[model samples]
Target: MIITDTHTHLYSNEFDEDRNEMIQRAIDAGVSRFFIPAIDSAYTHSMYDLEKAYPNTIFLMMGLHPTHVKDNYLEELQHVETELSKRKFYAIGEIGIDLYWDKTHLPEQQDSFRKQIQLAKQYKLPIVIHCREAFDEIFEILEEEKSPDLFGIFHCFTGNYEQALQAISYNMKLGIGGVVTFKNGKIDQFLNQIDLKHIVLETDSPYLAPIPLRGKRNESSYILNVVDKLSEIYNLSNEEIASITTENSKVVFGI
Candidate 1:
């Protein structure tokens, strides 16, 4: 079975020590596709190098992450636009409102988010959102930018069924990750009610590790934990879960 980790930061310094081994481990575990999200202009070279090294495995997205939005965000957005204009990107993402860390930059975050969404529309690419503690703000912007062409994944979605439906209304696929495997994750309870088509698998690795390995650093290979949990929750076989979610990922990333 082939599993797709639609969102992962393989280029992060977190993987610097054994990046090759970790990637091999993921391959051994049947995760063949890795979609890398951009943090800002700073990580672009690393991300591109990774794609070059693993040409068949890695796909790249371009965007300035919400947390990265700062006083000089306009310059960062210019960098994002320049890169996008220079080459092709799988998507425009990991961009959205994030108020959890600091609310001081909320307005800049909102502006960056809207600008990136416009960039995605201009390029005809889907967006991969990174929302935290700002659902109302994010949804408000999405509502304003709502159009036939504006659609993407709600990355690391851990909201309620109502939120799930609302995200779907915006034409986004819910990106299920390590949180689904947590005992108190809550999403597992209503996941079965959501169609498999509306869901895609991800690990958000070196971050939200799944149970049996929760509280530890996560890797792409650990995506198996998420697949196993999803199988149980959806009452389907692991292979089925992998295949369906992989296909759903393809539909979103156009891979």
Candidate 2:
């Protein structure tokens, strides 16, 4: 029952009122490991604070999110590089192309994505990609950067069977989260076709909450709902889903 939430923003201001209590709720529900993804330098201090508070359970990733690629992107990437040089991080990510919000920064996003991928290889760390309406763009960069060292999880994967296979070819494990529980969330249709080893569980908390909790704020504790849905999808018990996904996460994060 040691569930691992491979992606969650427990440091978000959304939890400012009861951060500790909310985390404890998730802990009580068996989500003991929380992998925190960085949006930019602004949240870096808060991420450190979170790690200090829960040293054992909190793991962090450093990167510049695609949407954050603005005029000051180089400076932000410098911050990412500086942080990586200073300490240990499980991965370099929550990074990749995000064309959903606006395509204005597409070129910059591509540059940032390429640079970050190189950084990941340099550090020998896995990458947790955040792709939205940009699979072809993400895959293009990944194709060019393909190597033995280019490996990680595809956070909040929402692609088709063919795309899943493509991502797997690049040595990525699909990060399944609350989206899998949605009625129209198509990944579940062919998820069983993909082996369990290629899957990892996540919540992307305060973002994509699963069914029954949809339209509401998500937390790590709500990951149990995702586990229950996965249990039905794979015809495995909840414990099996938790154990297997957590193990898969360790395979990527090496934690």
Over the stretch 1-255, how does candidate 2's per-residue lDDT look in tens digits? 899999999989899999999999999999999999999999999999999999999999999989899989999999999999999999998899998889999999999999999999999999999999999999999999999999999999999999999999999999999999999999999999999999999999989999999989999999999999989989999999999999999999999
TM agreement with the true structure for every prediction: 0.99, 0.99
Question: Which stretches of candidate 1 lie above 4 Å from their native place?
Answer: none
Q: List the residue pairs that clash in candidate 2.
A: none
Off by over 4 Å in 2: none
- Tens digits of lDDT, candidate 1, 215-244: 988999999999999889889999999999
**How high a TM-score does candidate 1 get?**
0.99
CA RMSD for every model?
0.6, 0.6
Candidate 2 colliding pairs, count:
0
